[model samples]
Target: MTWRARLLALDGLTPQLGDADRLVWTTLADAPDGAELVFLGLDDGRPCFAAIPAAGDAAPRLANPQLWGLMARLPAADLALYGGARSLIDWHARHRFCAQCGGDTRLAKGGWQRDCGACGAQHFPRTDPVTIMLVEYRGRLLLGRGLGWGEGRYSALAGFVEPGESLEEAVAREVLEETGVTVPSATVRYIASQPWPFPSQLMIGCHVRASNDAITLDTTELADARWFSREDVATALAGKGPFTAPPQQAIAHHLLHWWLNQPATA
Candidate 1:
C-alpha cells in the first residue's frame, strides 16, 4: 500500500486476477541483503509471503508495477491479508530497538515478534483504536472536515481512543471535544468496526445521540462542521448535496448509509 497523509492510498502491490478481483501475488524476490520477508499465512493451502524492501536496497526491475485501482472494491479476505502484512512489516521496520531497555531487537516467530537481546524483552505489533462517530440530533447527522480537507467534503468526526476510556465514553468525549456537542455515554451505540492499515489502526464506528443541535467550533481540530438532515445526507450519498460523503471504502460511509436507512424514531 502507498499512502500520503493517511488518506490517499493506492494498493500498488495488488493486481487484478479476474473481473474486479484483486490478488496479492508478487514476483519480487528476497534480495539485495537485509530485506524483510513476512510469512503471511496460507492462501488456499498455499503459503503466502510479502517482501519489504530495506532502505537503499536494490530490487528486481519490473515493467508492470501491478498497480491496481482504489482498494475500496478489494475482496474482504484479500484486504485483510494486505492489512496484516502491511502492519507486521511496518512494525518490524519501525521497532528495531526495544523500548524497555533501548536494546537492538531481532525478528522471531516468523515475523510476528521482535526479541530484544540486550533487555530480554519481546514486542509485538500494536493496533491503535480510533472512534468514528455518527453524531445524530433529532433528525440530522453531524459531519466535520479537518483542516486542509477539500472544501465541501465532510465525513464523520473521529479521534483516537484515549487510555482508560470505554468505547462508549470515547465516542461521547470525541463528539463533545470536536464539536462541543454533548452526547452522554448512555446514548452512544456501537455500529461496526474496520481494520485501517494506514499505520495499523482499528476504526471503531459508533452512533451517538446529542441532546441538542448546537455547534461550537474547535478550530484546532476541525475546519468546519454542520448537522445535515436525512435528505441532505441521502443527497450527498447520491453525489449531489451541500457536502460530499466519504468514499465507499471507509467505514464512515457505511455508518452514514446505515443511519440513513433507519426509521426516523431511531
Candidate 2:
C-alpha cells in the first residue's frame, strides 16, 4: 500500500502521472528535505499528501504550468484538492517568520499552524471572506467591470467583508460603494459559496434586490456599471452579446446562471 504524493512546484504545477490511472507516490525516503508536506486525508484507505519543494529547487520531471489553466481541465474533486494544497503551501511560504516578535517559525499541526521560536506565539493560516452578489432591480441584474478588465468584461460586484460586519451588511455596503445601488438588508439572500484559493479567500455568493435601477459608478473602483436584462445576460452567456460574462470556474458565473433560470417574481 503505497501512499500517493502530489509534488507541486512553487508555481503550483504538479507532475503529470503519464497515462497511469493513479498518482505515483514518492515515499518518505525519496522525498527531498525542506519540502513542505501536507496530509490531504486518505483516498481508498491510502494516505495522500501534497509536497511543495523549496524555492529555486526543482521537483523531478514535473511540468511548471499555471494552476488557473488546470481548473477547468481537471476533474472537480481533483481541482478541489489542488486548491487546498495550493492555499496551504502558499500560507506556509509567506509565514516563515512570526509577525508578533519577528521570530523564526516552524510548521505545526500537520501543516495547519506555525509555532514561533522566540515569542512562543502560535500563528495560523488566514482565509479572508468576500461577498459577491448579483443585484436585481426591475427584472434586471446589475454588473460592473473593474478598472483593467478591458472593454467588455463585466461580472457581479464583490468586496471583502470588513471586521464586525455581517454577510448581509457586507453585501449591501459593497453594492452601494461600487455601483451606488442601494440594497436593503431584507432583500439580500444567500445563495452558495466557493473556496477561491488564489491566496485563500472564501467567496460568499448572494442575490440582492436593489431599491432602484439607478447606478452611479465609482470611477476609482469600477470602469463601468450597468443593469442588464435577462435576455441580454442570456445572450452573453451564449457568447453572442457585445459584452462577456465571467468564466465558468468563478462563483460570479454560477450566481448569474442561477439567476437567469429563476422565474420572475413581484
By TM-score, the best candidate is 2
Candidate 2 lDDT over 112-212, as tens digits, reads 88999999999998999999999998898899998877688899999999999999999999999987889997888999999987668899999988898
On lDDT, the candidate that comes out on top is: 2
Candidate 1 lDDT tens digits, 170-259: 888888888889998998888999987666789999988899778898999999999899989999999997798897777989999999
Cα RMSD for candidate 2?
4.5
- The CA lDDT of each predicted structure is 0.75, 0.77
Stretches of candidate 2 exceeding 4 Å from the true structure: 3-33, 53-66
Q: Clashes per prediction?
A: 0, 0
> lDDT at 195 for candidate 2?
90
Off by over 4 Å in 1: 1-21, 27-32, 55-69
